[model samples]
Structures are given as C-alpha cells and as structure tokens.
Target: MDNRTNLDDYLAGLGISDAEESAPLPPAPDTTAAPLPDAANESPKAVLERFLRGLIARIDPELSVTVRETEEALEAEISGENAARLAGRDGRTLGAIEVIAYTVLAKQEGRGDLRVRVDVGGFRRRQADTLTKLAERLAIGVAKSGEPHELQPMPAAERRVIHIALKEHPDVMSESVGEGAARRLIIRPRHS
Candidate 1:
C-alpha cells in the first residue's frame, strides 16, 4: 500500500477520520524542575509524612493523613469524610499520588529509593482482600474446566496480590502476560 493508504488504514483502525487525523498532537509536558523540600535533616519517613499531610490538607482540611514505616515499605493512609475522593475510580488517583510521593521522597537527600504506598480509608487493604477472593474463585473455576482465564488489566501492585493469592493453589498456576497498560494475570490449571 502507498503511504497515504497505510496512514488511512491506521487512522481508520483508531476510529479517526481523515479530518480528525490532521489535528495536531498535544504539546509536550513542561520539564521544569519542581521545588524540592528542605529534607536534608529530616528522616525519609518524616519527609514523606510531611509531604502527604500537606497534600491531604490542601485537598480537604478535614481529612487526616498518617504514615507508618515497615521493613518492606512505607504506608500512608488518609482517613476522613472526603478520603474516598482520593481513591478515585479503581484507585487511579490514589495510585498516581502514591507514585508522585515515592518519586519525590526518593529524590530527597536522605531517602534514596524509598518505597511509599498511599491508601485512602483502608481502600488498598480492602481491595487486596477482594482481589484475593476473586482470584481464588476464578482459579477454582479454571481448575475444574481445564481452561485458562485472563483477568482484567491491573497495576503491578494489584497483579502481585493475585500472584501471591494463588501461589499455593494445588491445581492452578498464575502467570502475567502482555506489557504496560495491557498487562494482566492469566490463571490456568497446572499439568500433572
């Protein structure tokens, strides 16, 4: 096919017409440096807590944010009437804030490569429990039917919950497939 034909085919696949295809792409994001916190003397956890508290206060003054550190990671939890708003639909907003918090903390002088997780109203814990139960039910079905089942796309942290939930299942095996946004978990019966 000629270049025009190939371009037309690609645009058609994306449900875009020739006129729509001519629209300019969005501008690139600004790369200017953000102001860093004065974290030189603060511990990693302290700095993370300070940032998270300020973030929650700006969003909702009634909400309270707290941070706790464990050997594995730092957990930041928000509790209040408006905390669910931070959870967003399917926890996207909560996840994004967690990512930004981790990035900022890791860049601080004393908190290199710190791991921080943000949760609103115990949403993460409840979501993990729900996912684990669903995984168990699906694994049983896949084992009985001897058919592989692909789960909905989930973030890496959520996918990890699925894997851990089924790791000890006697008749089912779990594997992650695809890449990036399309990545998901597949449950299949183990071969005897």
Candidate 2:
C-alpha cells in the first residue's frame, strides 16, 4: 500500500523489469527528423548563384546580381553606379572577385575544380571573343607568309584562349614563349 519509492530502488526495479516496460522507451522512433538535403541534384551553377548572393549581401546590401550559366561556366552580371568599383581597373577587381567566388562555391559543393566567371556589363565575354578573332587572324597571316608572327604579351587566360582557338589549325602552329610579363604567343607556319 506504500507508494513511496527510493531513487536507487526505483532504478533497480526498472532494471529488473521486463524489456516491454523498462527498455529505455525505444528512442521514440524519430518521426519528426529533418530530411537530408538533395545535394545530388545541386550543380556548380547553383552553388555560384548562392555564393554571389552571399557576396552581395555582405558587400553591397542594396545592389543585386544576376547569375547565368553558360556552356562552360557560371557567369554573374551586376549593375549599379558602383559597378565600376567592382569591375576595378581593366576588370582586375572583377577577376579577383571571381577567384573568391569560385573558392567559396568549390568549398560548398565539395569540389576542387568548380569554374566561375564574374563579369560586369559583359566586358569579359566581349574581350574573349575579340581576342579569339584576333588570334585567328594572326594565325591566318602566319600560315600564309610561312614566317613566325609574334603577338603582344598577354595573361595566361588570354594565351590559353589563343592556343585553344588555334589547336585545330592545320596550316599554322601556336606556341607560347618568354617569361613572366614578357610571355607571348608565336604563330608560325606548320611544317610542310
């Protein structure tokens, strides 16, 4: 008739009790647990968009950026009176921003090689296309004259575009030479 129970006796009684009553309540079955996120469907483009959103949120709370994915990479287009500030001198700022954005997205997606391109007012795309055409023209000239044509020194990315554009050329050969700031592409006639 006495319902009073000591703490040690209560614990011992539970231990001695059958599993149906004392087995620590079986953990409640976890019905309200959150579903795992669908990272499998996530792409480099989505990560890039999220990264740019974060950057804009921190740097320019009032400014908005639009992101698009081309066939090869992610591109972000931003506009504002301070857009030039983001673009920097000859787009150096934009390029630096791009490196940071790519790093962020790569880390988020567990990727080491994510490609991201940040541009202001379509400058980079225009520059790349124009440089590609120039390379093609120079390659044609070198092919016709059978003499090596030296081009102005360019950054690694531009040089890479030139090389890739001329990769299929049957009449000319493209080679990058020199050191540091002096490096340039030399287009010459292919061997007969």
TM-score of each: 0.75, 0.62
State each model's C-alpha RMSD to the native: 13.4, 17.6
Predicted candidate 2 versus true structure: per-residue lDDT over 1-192, tens digit per residue: 343234224322322111212222111123332322243465767556644654554566555678887787777887655665667787788888888677656645667765677876666777789988998899878888888999999888789888888889899878999999999999888884
Best by TM-score: 1
CA lDDT, every model vs. true structure = 0.75, 0.67
Question: What digit string (tens of lDDT, one per residue) describes model 1 on residues 1-192?
Answer: 597567445333322223343333222233332333344556778767766755664577678778899998888889998788789998989988888677657655334567788899889999999999999999889988999999888889999999999999999999999999999999989973
Indicate the residue-level lDDT of 126 in model 1.
97
